[model samples]
Target: MEFDKNFKTHSFRATFITDLLKEVPIHIAKDIVGHEVVSSTEIYYRSSLTKKDSLKILNSVDTLRFN
Candidate 1:
């Protein structure tokens, strides 16, 4: 599929880091990117998750079962 013209190589990095944040600890994600601080890597997670994305994440949690 053709991505947007605005898409750049850094976009892939951001997406990868964002996905990593969903599955792994912040420290691990930061290490993977060779960042000195977890806060640096967290920028990708925060920016990638917009208001609409936040709602989608909450909606996905509705399907889970808990004790």
Candidate 2:
């Protein structure tokens, strides 16, 4: 048997997931990536929550508190 050059593999899936995470919301990403459910996308493709992201949230809260 021969494999096609366009065949999907684990590394391709990983790259797709990473791009989706960077570009789209969970629900949209799920659909584009062919996940049956949002939970699956959330479980599989979610990026690590970062301190910079947290800091942005905290700054928004701080601004709200002062207004």
Candidate 3:
């Protein structure tokens, strides 16, 4: 059996950290990834929200009804 040419064990580290960031706080993600500094982890995840996306979220929030 052979793996893909680009398959490096460490290649998924960035994606792992990025997905982890989506589910956990930055400090937690940093600790999970074993980075001594948060700055090193900061470059891995991006929120990337556009103006339209923000407005969509705001509109969705407006639809919430509390009893």
Candidate 4:
């Protein structure tokens, strides 16, 4: 709730944006942050990776395969 004034904004912003986009829907995040609309959240956040990036990681894991 409370953060020091000298705390690194870039690190905090990166963590906040990553968690916002990669974990939950924009609307839900907007609500959590008291934004009136999902677009407000989207304007400030973006994903570092696409769905294809996630699929590539999943494919590379090789923990399971269809027989």
Please name the candidate that would achieve the greatest TM-score relative to the true structure: 1
lDDT tens digits, residues 39-60, model 3? Answer: 9898776566899999998888
Against the reference, the lDDT scores of all candidates come to: 0.82, 0.79, 0.81, 0.73
Model 4 vs. true fold: TM: 0.48
lDDT of 3 at 39: 92
Poorest stretch of ten by lDDT in candidate 4: 58-67
Which candidate number has the best lDDT? 1
What's the distance in Å from true for residue 11, model 4? 6.2
TM-score winner between candidates 1 and 2: 1
* Ranked candidates (lDDT, high to low): 1, 3, 2, 4
Tens digits of per-residue lDDT, candidate 4, 1-67, equal 9988888876675568658767787778888777798766776674677899989988877656632
What is the per-residue lDDT of model 2 for residues 10-58, given as tens digits with 9 covering 90 to 100?
6567667777788778788888888899887766663556999989999
The estimated TM-scores of all candidates read 0.58, 0.55, 0.56, 0.48
Clashing pairs in 4: none
Better of 2 and 3 by lDDT: 3
List runs of model 4 lying over 4 Å from the truth.
Answer: 1-11, 50-67
Model 3: lowest-lDDT 10 consecutive positions: 58-67
Query: Which of candidates 1 and 3 is the stronger one according to lDDT?
Result: 1
